[model samples]
Target: MNEAEAAVLIALLHARPRKMSWSAIASEVALRGSATALWDECFPPTLEGVNDLDGHLARAWESLEAWRSEDFRLLTVLDRKYPSRLREIHQVPPILFVRGQLRDDEVAVSVVGSRRASDRGRAVAARIAEGLVDRGIAVLSGLAEGIDAAAHTATLKAGGRPIGVIGTGINRSYPASNRALQAEVAKCGAVVSQFWPGAPPQKHSFPMRNATMSGLGRASVVVEAGEHSGARIQARLAVEHGRPVILTDMVVGATTWARDLLARPGVYLANSTAELMDLVDQLTRTAAGIDDWSNVLPDLVDH
Candidate 1:
């Protein structure tokens, strides 16, 4: 693996996934490229609590070997297989462990919400997911409780490829209840994690995982979120990455941020997938920019 890729997996092992800042990571790579270019070239290093570079490198190597043996595959930012949309995000994960198939569908949308979603929120998410999937648009979300779970299930129920990006390890599901859903995702779509196998779900992992959800999608539809929710953070990240943020007032009583997001200059306001599908259809027609990885490392393969 390249140094950046190694660093990213190491960072995940370090439990400091969010610490892989763009400028700092770019500095580490020694690549004379733009921040976006550098992000596309390096993996987020997981070097938590290591004061010495040598010690960090040593721990990273050990983590790499352990991850490799467990069938955990790494897709470096330099890899051609890296998602183009995700590469656009500034806080994107440098290295991702993919457990299943990742489709090259042109239109991908993330459906996100609170972990403790209301029944109405769950129904809406499922409905939105079904509508998107029926149009051949890929549904992406965190495989969490409530709305996220509803979205993934609806997509699979519609016989569509639904991508589930998680904060926990691919081998273990957080909340534990979604284990079967995780398996279905691996079978029908993909179960992706920046965290290595056996990595615990720490408090910070949730927000860190949100960037992946937003980056992987052309637009994100947030059905519900509290004032300072991770879902809300993801909506902002989507805007930062130049993807449209679609806000839905799923509940009768919604926060000011939700209303404000709806009124934002570039953010799209949608109450249902029918309204959002037009945007998905529009984005789906665009061709992905070709990104070749052959020049980066020549021939370095790591699981």
Candidate 2:
């Protein structure tokens, strides 16, 4: 099948009957045939309870046509526009619902922290975002309150790209206040989700959102986070995805998560914008051309 057809098929598969594991989807695609042929040749028992082959295929096609009628774009793993870096994650989503745009080669850095950020923390997050944009890096964040809001606003103010990886469906707003901000991101950058179009923002959805945030970025910076902050989990997941995690001196001194992250070899500590930029340079170089990001980004710092 074509990429779009395969993508829609996967999207429909997840929407009904039951959601299959991402690895299973990946393996089926590896069979080197069209998705329709794969489905025909190997109908897993998972869908047997729902309907016969013809019935299931019809439902899949119907759902694909329905979603296509909307503005949302379903990207399957087989799509060329699908992000390579995100595929490195342990539990990659088989289908991503995108409402805006995605650049295959842009350098993005996720800046995140507590929803209940201190005033100082908010200021710092904005500063970091501004700095990242000055060097032509896109600012990535969950479109939540506090630090996430601060980062996205600063990115927009700087006329830089802001990628909002959200928990709720692409059409729905989470945290409510970010409704406008999310719209702006869709206008100039991207607002993406793996959830169905009407999926609500459950407590569990945030972690799923964080994983996508961590996966897309070159690295993640935690400006400020309490001990129980979700940013801490994002930082951990970033490291697991083979990206460096940067924390401010303030964050490093604030909680056990920071202290332990500081002990990790790939993690780095920064106290100022200058230091953060310096660390970014050092880490990218030491990553042994994890990507030739510096060469590709002429507007980057030190370029």
Q: Which candidate number would show the highest TM-score if scored against the true structure?
A: 2
Q: 1-303, model 2: which lDDT tens digit per residue?
A: 264456435643653323555545654554453455455445553554423444655655666778878877877767778887777777576668887888878888899999999999999999989988887889999999999999999999999999999999888998898899999988889998987788898988898889888888888999999998999989888877777788888888899889887665457778777888776666544554664322332333220
Q: What TM-score, computed on C-alpha atoms, does each candidate reach?
A: 0.77, 0.85
Residue 254, candidate 2: C-alpha displacement in angstroms: 1.4
| Overall local distance difference test of candidate 1 | 0.70
Backbone clashes, each candidate: 7, 1
- List, residue by residue over 1-303, the lDDT tens digit for candidate 1: 465455543543353324655424533432443223333333333456433343554677676767667755777665667776665666767667888878544567899999888898898899889888888888999999988999999999999888998998778897799999988988888889876567899888887898888878867888877887778888877766766666774631477777666544446555555665655554454424513211222222110
The true-versus-predicted C-alpha distance at residue 292 of model 1, in Å, is 25
C-alpha local distance difference test of each model: 0.70, 0.77
